[model samples]
Target: MSGQAQSPAKPPPELSTSDASGTVSAVAGTLNGLPEDPQMTPLAPPRSTPPSKIPLRPRKIQKLSSDNLKPSMTNLSASAPKPPSSKKNRADARRSSSDALAVVIPRVAARSLSCEGEVETALRHLCAVDPLLVPLIEVHPPPNFDTFHSPFLALTKSILYQQLAYKAGTSIYSRFVALCGGEHGVVPEAVLSLNPQQLRQIGISGRKASYLHDLARKYQNGILSDSSIVNMDDKSLFTMLTMVNGIGSWSVHMFMIFSLHRPDVLPINDLGVRKGVQMLYGLEELPKPSQMDHLCEKWRPYRSVASWYLWRLSEAKGGPSGVASAMAATGVSVQHHQHQLQQPLPPPTEEQQQQLVDPINSILNLGYSEFHFSS
Candidate 1:
């Protein structure tokens, strides 16, 4: 893969369509003993909402996804200090038995990867090199990558997640999702429900509310759309998207992954990507974007796929912040991007107890030291 400069002019060529509807299915525990898919869209948010953000409704606790925290790190364990063993903890447990954000298998839709012909040549070679990455070709095949939604909503969520822990972003997203619909999908009218104040009440920061409203209004009017995006290349998409409030290249990078599903998005600036690169390539500092472009060169068409795995690998190695947020301010998924805060620890195991930057500690609001489990 050639490490071209990160130019807004460089466009990612399209990928040919491949059908792969075969999903690895599994059951998830639920809010009321009923199975639920977390990716399921929520009912539409009320239309004509006040521009002033509305306050979020009282939240209900639901069971979380087992996948929220991967099982590979079983050696590590730290319990949320058993809350006061009083009625509070008991009620807490009961109420939490049905929190709104329960675990659900992400319902991935079939999407076609369309790009210029030349890019495909580079992408195919990259896929051949890694057997593990072969799954991305099969699982996320072209069709599985198409996203049909407002680019702005996805970008806003990404912004909200910047530097934040997964749980933190999830909390904010749940509220935002509630605004759009009930819990999972965004509805234009639902977002139009309240004035900005009502949006702020839902826990969206003042700036983010403006971004969402702009996104909604544009989406409502069709300024944001697949047809509009399809003709434009990646650079164009980035340029068009960043026009909204609170959006940046990093946020746009995330949008490429989840929304545009653009193949080959290299978020060299992303902390998680940097950390993962360090772990994989044995670098002292995150390889600079120039260096990263060279390293990721082989992952070409499947670079996005490879990047996704690299992120999972980082999570497994112990930071465990993948896909959730811990801190609230940055809203960036602390685990989503990788940055080495301190020198990487000499590898440690469960009994040894490494406080290897676990976001769960902060996200769950726990004071964690090492892993401990008591039967």
Candidate 2:
């Protein structure tokens, strides 16, 4: 056996199962003796502890007194986290809130002169006050005064129409408006920009151009303004506008009645108004301008409306104006004028004929040939 030289040295024999188990236990004990790695350590299940009772104590929550006080930013981040929101959702929320506010608010509001109920009330008042006006009211549809023209613009147009026939005045006004940019563009600056020669070129006379310039300068100087004109009382307005070169009391009255739709203007100087008065009362001669205020006392507070009917009366052929004829047409009995139409009335004087064209010089006293306009 010693000579088995060539045979490799005998190797250690393999361990038995019992011996291997003991060796594995020794290795495991060596591993337990070493320090445990924190990351590599397996977590143990949480241990169940016995419940403890907390003693109740009452305390008031401290309230923040200052409006400027804010919660801590650190607490905000640490508290329950919210899921991210999209921009569209935030916009939708804002839009819904705005829509709710819109529904809660009102849309239409009452506006000046927009109340038709006022018109009905005025009509009822008129019918109750004057029996003659009742027929007129029933025969005609109610007057619809929806338009409110700027006083400045109306004054400008009235300036162009002064002392001229309707057609001639209209043509001149169109040309004048063209010179300035348009009707809407007829402001003080535009009128002032054009010289007397330029205005004359547009069919405005030299005198009328001077008048327009004077009006423009007054506006530029702040002595007269749209607001001032509109706010002025009737007497004060008559005085102020008459100070302008071409504007007169007659023109002011006409403007107040037609342009401003003033409720109680009586154009005593107006020829048509006088003629209407003559026919309404069946007078032998036209009533003097001085007597007009006394004769038409019943038409107060609605004199402008009465004046409108009066103008229609002069154009009518027979009866107590057209309004009475309208009453007769509606089955109401009209007390006809008992005065017979004998000889044809003499032609009106040259002064009276001039009144047909001249607005300012139309006021006349009975038997007086000429009358001057006073502010």
Candidate 3:
């Protein structure tokens, strides 16, 4: 080994400007020392080749004839979309939809006391709920609804009887029925066919004649019908009936109870009912019409029978005299008094007349006979 440290070895040569210009050549020269300048030599022109000697063939063209141009009916029918359904088809579809709905949603049979054993059932229910009603129920015979009259006839009779005494109303009703030919002929058509003069001749007032015509027109227009009225719920029937010119809530209540024999009806506007309720419950003041529903809630599903007892209670207290005093005390008009008197009641028999002076005593002494309510 040398006495002094050997000198550091030299590094390998790096690419410089001269090497890039191809002026210097080394064993590791790039691109074999070729010049990078484009002007160094001109490139040779591309050689041209001669076109091929083979000839091209042309495609043959053909023209379409009239027969080929014409559209095919079978193809058109198969490709075209169908037209919209006709009116008859739409109507049939609606009918089918209605039938399907009818099957899915069953019709509710109307609740009525006129049905067999309904009054008996109602009386049992009232007796069970209210002990006080037992005495009254025991004394009074169950109301009979066997005399089912047509809704139109009942409604017409009720209108004629409004604000009139029973004897006078009965006389007018007889004449009105005769004009229509008979009770069976008292239809909407017959009522509408009668002129105002004809109605006036039968003792119907001008206002009342207008009311009757309005009712008949409603029936003709499909707004009201016997079946519709019979099948309607109490609230809906009240709303519908009150739309007539002269029919009020009081009239509707009477018709529902006496004619339709609906069980849950409580005539709140009725003076007799109010008096009876007051007497039965011993209230300091008469119940407001609005309060009647809440007070009579327990008698539900048989309030009609309970109301019948109340009428009897009112009658037993003082007959028409007590009712008249109540009307006067309440500031009720003469018209209202007449309206109260027009409510359906069986004419007082000789025994009933005697019992009127002391109804409770009479009921306990001589029990009621078979009495049926009708309009």
Candidate 4:
């Protein structure tokens, strides 16, 4: 207790003991709650006395076998049970399926006028729908398509006849046939064999020779064939034919009605048809081509027959000025032209005939003239 401040006494060292009976030794100091020596290592609290009843080892994860993974019979019966469909739903599904099929399938060609009894059927239908046509139908013999020519020959003749007078067209066609050896030899190969010079020598203009060559080339290339032409639908045939150099929509209409004998074709652009419609209905001005479809809507399915009658009607003895007089005999009233009846309509000149029958020729001629001038 002097001013030197003496240190406190240290604790006694731990005493260790061993037993000969093989029991664990104990450290007396540690049992008495003395701190362990700093230099000595400590024992981990006797590894949490593992439960005497060992904890069940977690079960191992295993993949399920396919047999065990299969759906139960009860589940199969419960899942995807089809709801009952009404008749309307079934019909709608069928209709939609048919519509889808129609999109992929090409249209079948319709029966032509040449089919047996078709003319008679058309005549009866026309008479029933249009009383004004009865007289014309009776006056003119029914059209016969039995003499239909091969598509190549017919097309060749059409090209030759375009815009020419009857005599001139006939002369050119005769010469052309002779050049090809005969009508029987007017195949695509024979036509293609003829040079432009030879065609020109036969009185064919350079433009016409070019048109013929184009048609022949298309045929030779298999772009067109007689069988395909015969089997094609009217619209398909028309579209394909007009792809030829000189064949126009007007020519296609004429070919469809006369050559192919299509049952339902109306020459909406034909001057004769327009004039006939005007006279038949007694209109002051000619009917526009745009209005033809509506005005002649009643002539569907038998429009080709009606058109034939119109051609005859327009060229009948009295003509435009005397439609009233001529139609009066047929019991068709044309009161609009009653006053003009006394004035005879002069016979159509060659130019007028070409205009009415082959208007495309005139347009081609105009084009040819411009081409000539430009050249």
Candidate 5:
């Protein structure tokens, strides 16, 4: 064993300058293959420590208390900020809700012309749309009108004035009011108390007497209350009031404009409005009812106001002579359209038919069991 070990260990190889250059080149290539410059920094040492041997921070698991486990509304409320309770906040919310509703809801701008400012704005809009209306506007100041709180009395007066001269109708209305005890006393109950003979004595037609009684009974029975009439929209009121024995479309239109002060009644069946349109545009003939709606579209939302002016225009210079002069000034000739006027009375529905028979049959003493209403 000593002899075998006797071979002396060889000395380490000494590198020459060429070999040193080659070794330097090999080291440079290996350094280039490394992720980072090993020449500038030392390589990290391999870890020998076991995972369990390494020191670590202990984890904390907190247990929930009995109070925390059961979530209470009171606790949640206490944790959160309170909502606003101010009146201003409520009003702002209401306004925002109203604005949103306005987008969804349809607006009836036509009924908004009751105020003076609305009238003026409408007039300005009309003037801007049709320059020809300027002369008519200049010829007359805008009419001042008001709504009658007593729709019943207004409707009664309308019935009495149907087809009669203004002065004569006023006289009959005065007598009728006196019979009912006063203007204020002319309610449904008072009207129902008067017999047909009593109404006849006051110069009311037998048919009109029935109409008055029917109107009174309707009011008494809560079918057509003053409040309901006042609150009804134009089309609804027109439908409702026209169901009465004597009230027709023309009467409804007049009542809507003068009594209810509805702003947008065209009254196309009205001879006065047609005559006014004729004069306003200087057409050779009167405009037809179909054309009336289209021609006077500009006067919408203020047609009642315009109708008042037209009535004035019709009465002025003995009916339409004044309109002619206004037309001559413009020298614009509009085409005349002639169409038959439509009957304002629609066929009675089942409900209306029932109302018609009861109130009307009670008042009229004719041998017949029922009577049909006609305008």
Candidate 6:
């Protein structure tokens, strides 16, 4: 390489000027004692060339843009896509919702006139807590003015169903009806003439047997006739019915609704009702009676209707639902459902068959047995 000396002073103007010639001239000019124009010079020999990166393997590019492809709603590491919550993604949602409103509008129009305001407020609260429950309750109504009838036997049947499931209770009740006069099972004389020991023998638990007898005695004695219960307020009536043995607050609530047909009764203590609430609320723990009561307070006079809706919701529940499976994704055990009764009674045996066929009334001297159905 030809060595070019670094200039210590500015080049003269003639030397600094570029002429038509292409030759590059190095010269020196000075400011004070220092060079004004810096001449370009080589410092040190060049280092080796920059190392090239290993060429990347070419990837296939997707031709479709985002709009052409279904949008993914999953977490980065997860393969499963979540449900879309976007409005555009939910196009049919508005139509389904409006049709739902159409169904709801007529129902509100058809509600009990006196309790309309309370029903509105309570249902508003209920829908807020559980959007699904509203439609169920709207379709299924609870006991009301038209459902109740004044009779000992009808009310007794409803009480027998207490804490029992719909199907089991229906089966047991059918057997009980056949035991009682069947079709004509509930007259004053039919129950008054029933042998307490005989009724107890027909699969009626000891406590329930006593309850029936006490109820029979009171009805016969005029202590609590149909009128007496109908006129009594909710609290008084519940207390009066609960006075009977084996009949807890639950039974009394049933009696009030099905028999007395009282409005505003809340069966907060019922396991089914509470289970429904727990399921709807998606709770980790089942709520206590106090918590159920506090939550149910908004239901007020329409609590029975709210309860019916909740029961319907409970019926609609699937085992280990999507939410449950999601919760289980974290490897936690989530109790999916709660059964009302343990080890349900088995279907038909000789004892049950005999009880069903037995006479409601006895011969003049003996209790209801040894009597056969007339052809």
Q: Which residue pairs in candidate 3 collide?
A: none
lDDT of each: 0.53, 0.62, 0.68, 0.69, 0.62, 0.51
lDDT, candidate 2, 121-192, per-residue tens: 556655666666665556445544444445666678777866654446667878888877786788999999
How far is 134's C-alpha from truth in model 2 (Å)? Answer: 3.6
Better of 2 and 3 by TM-score: 3
Candidate 1 structure, TM-score to reference: 0.46
For model 5, the superposed segments whose C-alpha errors exceed 4 Å read 1-116, 320-375
lDDT of 5: 0.62
Residue 122 lDDT (model 6): 53
Model 3 regions lying over 4 Å from their true place = 1-111, 319-375
- lDDT string, candidate 3, 41-105, tens digits: 33343467897776477666788899888999889989996443798877888898899998998
Scored by lDDT, model 4 comes in at 0.69
TM-score of 5: 0.55
- Residue 38 displacement (Å), model 4: 65
In candidate 3, what residue range of length 10 has the lowest lDDT sum?
360-369
lDDT (Cα, tens digit) per residue for candidate 6, span 1-375:
248876679766573223312123222223245443344442343478989887698677879877767656454338665454797657667777888898877322223312335445556666775566766656544212333234466556644544443345556556677877683566565765667576666655566666677777777877776666656778887787777665567656655543443446677665556767887778888788889878776555566657755644544452111211122221233233223212322343343222111111000001111122121
TM-score of each: 0.46, 0.55, 0.57, 0.59, 0.55, 0.46
The reply for model 1, stretches above 4 Å from the true place, is 1-127, 130-153, 159-164, 180-193, 220-222, 324-375
What ordering of candidates by lDDT runs from best to worst?
Answer: 4, 3, 5, 2, 1, 6
lDDT tens digits, residue span 187-295, model 5: 8888889898998898888988888898988888878887687677889888888889887776677667655557788888766578778987889987888899998
| Residue lDDT tens for model 1, 85-167 | 88878888877765644545342222324334423443455566755545434433222232244443445455555444455
Q: Is candidate 3 or candidate 4 better by TM-score?
A: 4
Those runs of model 4 whose alpha carbons end farther than 4 Å from true positions after fitting are 1-110, 317-345, 349-351, 358-375
